[model samples]
Target: MSSAVIDLKNCDNCPIRHRAVCARCEPDELEQLEDIKFYRTYDAGQPIMWAGDQMEFVASVVTGIATLSQTMEDGRTQMVGLLLPSDFIGRPGRVRASYDVTAVSEVTICCFRRKPFETMMVTTPHIGQRLLEMTLDELDAAREWMLILGRKTAREKIASLLAIIARREASLHLGKTGDGFAFDLPLTREAMADYLGLTLETVSRQISALKRDGVIALEGKRRVIVPDFDALIDETGDDADGGLLS
Candidate 1:
């Protein structure tokens, strides 16, 4: 864990600038944000926020991955979601965090003081509009996860997770997905199993199966290379365009 510093000098070169909550901000509005923004970095496996904790700021993920999980009364925890680059954390008017946020990899976020951010949201229509769009997208993703967990087969589930990560990585870097695109798997097999509701053995087996089938290649334990993005999408059992056939 580390504290914040004034580091807005690189805002123009920020990788997630076009996709983040500030995407719609005008230059003047961005300068307004810079006044309140600072950076926070967390090491892998660090807890960013615990459920019910007071949230002093809202942020956008600048890099790395994090998980949103909840612990039940019985002490069992479920990983409910992942936050990738450009993902927003905290919400306007929210005084406390709802889930446990943990870093799955080394993470960096650009944070704004909650009070100032909330005030800016009132005067800045673009910020409010973009947040609403992201909220809706989150809702859609939650519904899709319900389908994946409730009905998808083990192989399909693994494929779906891979496709999701690959797509997000591509969007942040290349603006698209295609053959020969490579990305590092941020989660270990055990974590993948926990997130997907499968056994570690099952997670390893499905990954091996995908490799054997030539749907993907592995440069190492964590680096996954897709030979054909379409094939991986096929394995996910999802519509290619994520829409009803038209």
Candidate 2:
């Protein structure tokens, strides 16, 4: 399929624009991004970069979903990160990818040549500061996932993943209803299993159990409706009185 065209004019309205590379940049700095940024698209299931492959650019998701995964010698794989629209991908300083990046859905990315981007970041303090902030947020998310993998129960892991996805989707204005909302589950059972450190059978079983308990309603295999956000979080094994961010 042909790649989707990215509208540069929409950059100002992007949810992450202020929180990402352009956050601290002057109008002139944004003009530089317009000059060097280009669009690339990947089909569903396509590998954007392989582990240890040389990456020539850094990118941010313009549309659709992607995943970062690492595999062991024996073929056991773990999903380390999920990328959504406006989420940055690839590394500024790294030449070789540490994990395999794959498009979980048809995806469009805003790309910049690494050399120019690196130089621009150095010359632009705003962009550099924004990138540092984003990196720190990603690091925190990675540590949260580590806790999930190391400590949470199967049901709690599944709940935590669903809660995270729902919160992000809602933040992106993809919610279907009020605070109680519905959205498609972007990952497959096997993908969920990889992310949550469970067997596919276990993932399937837990999803079914959640449906049975009325914590979530399923319109189909991929569609989910959460009627009570707090209840879903309760299933995640977080402190009952704590807030979502806690």
Candidate 3:
């Protein structure tokens, strides 16, 4: 991966500033972060970190997508999570990375040196509180993923994945027009197959089926247009309110 630094955007103008780890910071806190922050860019498919590597800094994704994967002794790797824009990249108390992180798209991150960040967290209650909230959010998403992988059909899996990405995009104030939205599918069919425990052909077939049924539309190969967000959610086999229906 290239280690080149990019021109830094001031924290106030950063796209992810409001949702990122520094979201709750006051003016002084932001200034403190600025003192410690730097920007790094990585090309798509480049390794950002390996399992068991020393992590000298913690970061928040400023743009693009990344993935967290773990490799087994047999040399097989399973992607465990996706880091969308504004996602945090490290745990404060952790000295080493537990998963291999890779850029799924060209990515940029705002990083703070670990020692100073940990000290700041001790002095700054907002940072710690926000981190806790984000961790719990991640845990909830993991539970949903377990249900998807264990019980959902192939079609449901694809739809669920799409819905998840679309929801994340919506949170970032992107691609929303009423109840419909659009986003570029970041993962290849092969990658989606691996993550969803389906064959590549099955992944393609299910996407085609979604298009045929008017649940979604496509522009070129990767851009997906959800005509009705609720209609797409119906295909995920999930309750609209995220609870059991009466």
Candidate 4:
């Protein structure tokens, strides 16, 4: 997921100014965006869009988490993506929803109506280019995920997931890691199982194994603390500097 633009009261002071689609936009271009953009929020468990539904807006997550998932014919739901703060939502050119998007936590999103945004895209080459960059970033993240899923064993997969989220969160905040850090697992065990393609029992068991091995500590059920970040990386069988390798 793409990180969010920092908007401290309005677009003018947005921190993500250099990374968002508007990164290269001029003052006038920003002003035009300020005119068309608005914010919408969803409560946890709320549906942002059902697959096959008509979607009217594309947005950026300002806060919280969203899940992109699809239900199979037998009603098995599988998670395909996790959207974190600053991640883009909606396809710029698509008119129909491609998957069911749900707010896994309370979510606030900065929204742009699709038609207007598309019109702006035509007039602004920078927006087009920044979008390409974001798409490429997504591809890089996906490749990393595929490696985790395809080759890693269940314990390794869970460790890799924890490592990736920790690294990504640090990159979003301080842009680097220190000795260690802590974060809550945003997804429930069931959700994690769906994403990892594991049974819920297996997910819980591997987590317990990691905690038992001293790779991670569980403050409670969801909170995780890594005493040594490199040790956690060691559990993943990756080089010490990774968790974002693609």
Candidate 5:
């Protein structure tokens, strides 16, 4: 499919620029990024890269969501990472992808060619430091997910996923206040099941149960509103003080 057409000047408004690769870059470094950066888009359900595929560049999400999933030879798939808006994808110094990256929703990405970016990293301390911080944050998130996959109960898994999405959504739209807030669920039921290591039926059933128990209200299969964030966290087996995963 053809990638989405977007202007590079739009980088000024990019959420990830101030948060990811460009966060601590010097003015000249930022200027260098502008010269090499390009934009690409993917439709929902499209595979951005397959495991073991050679990746030529690294990118950050400009919009929409993506996921990194690994499948065993026997076909058991586990989602290892969830990429939201502004989240970076691909790894520096890695040529082959380690997981399947798929667009969970129609997505746009701001891409920087790996060769030039790597060269700049060596010459620019600020850029390298920012990249290191971003990479470490991703590692921390991945480790947290490992715990979710290996130890959390099915219900806890689902709740943890919801809380995560809700928190991210809240962060994305800062300053919005209310007892309830709505956001689109980027993953399909089948995708959620794969991520949570549950059957599709179990994912569907648990969502229904959450709705029935008043933990969340669903406007449709994709739209979700948490009436109470703390209550939802409670369902995740998290401490009332939000210390469970911490």
Candidate 6:
């Protein structure tokens, strides 16, 4: 979320280079993708795409975070997913979006026209295969989210959500390890409440509890510093060892 303007010409040095949709492409394929690719930026809190809107393109988040949420006719809203750097923005073959996607922070996205990208997916086995892998990972995360909603205590939910974002931020910036790192909380208390199925008061209280217990440290309202990422992970109620039992 820097104030500097973006230039789209340098795809080779792009920050999310290894994790993006074109991660597996060869030079020739990447050249072709560059020919069709475009970049767009959204300010924090801006709506990127509304639910049921006809999507003109698919995108990969180049930087920053976004939220996928839904709104009812009566105006009730729930946050359903998060889009981090390297996260795919739209589904192939889907012309209309099913959820409202809004920028949670200053954001930039690498975009591909939907029809042409769909055609590329059909012709390029590597692209299709990689996309399938990403899709499966998304499915697994979604199921884990279901478990979080249905089973986790309120404190565990906050810890789990923090761990997820911290891990992604670390991967994007500091490789895969999360220790001795800091990231701004992408969601507001209200948004976290919606995403975690808790009241805003509950979200605030749990976060305060984590801070009190030294699982996390906060600078002002949003910045989170993890002195020991392992400690935070332990609070998430997940297997600390990721134990393999026969």
Which model scores highest in lDDT? 1
Q: In model 4, what are the clashing residue pairs, if there are any?
A: 3-86, 4-86, 6-16
Candidate 5, 22-128: lDDT as tens digits:
77766776777788888888998898889998888888887888999999999999888888777777877889889899998898888888898889778887777
Tell me the TM-score of model 3.
Answer: 0.87
Clashing pairs in 5: none
For all candidates in order, the CA lDDT equals 0.85, 0.84, 0.84, 0.80, 0.82, 0.83
Give per-model TM-scores.
0.87, 0.89, 0.87, 0.88, 0.90, 0.87
The clash count for each model shown is 0, 0, 0, 3, 0, 0
- Off-target runs (Cα >4 Å) in candidate 4 are 1-19, 239-246
- Give the C-alpha miss distance for residue 73 in model 5, angstroms: 2.3
lDDT of 4 by residue, 1-246 (tens): 322434434744232243478777897888888877776678888888889988788887777899999899897887878988767778888999899999999887777889999998899889888888888988898787787778889988898889878887787677455555888788899989888778899999999999999888898899988878888888786666544666
Between candidates 3 and 5, the TM-score winner: 5
Q: Tell me model 1's lDDT, rounded to 2 decimals.
A: 0.85
How well is each residue in 1-246 modelled by candidate 2, as lDDT tens digits? 455556654464343355567866677777777777777788999888889998898888877899999999999999998988778888889998899989999988877889999998889877778778888989999998998999999999999999888888787785543545898899999999999989999999999999999999999799999998888988999876655564
lDDT of 3 by residue, 1-246 (tens): 576766554855353356766677887887777778788899998999998999999988888889888778996666778887778898888999999999988988878889999999899988888889888999998889888889999999999999987887687675464455788889998778767777889999999999999999999989999989889889999988767656
What tens digits encode model 6's per-residue C-alpha lDDT throughout 1-246? Answer: 323335656665343245656677787777767666778888899899899999998888887889899888997788888887778888998989999999989888888888888888887778888888878988888888998999999999999999888887787575655466789887899999989888999999999999999889999999999989899988989988655653
Clashing pairs in 2: none
Name the better of 5 and 6 by lDDT: 6
Model 1: clashing residue pairs? none
Name the lDDT value of residue 163 in candidate 1. Answer: 93
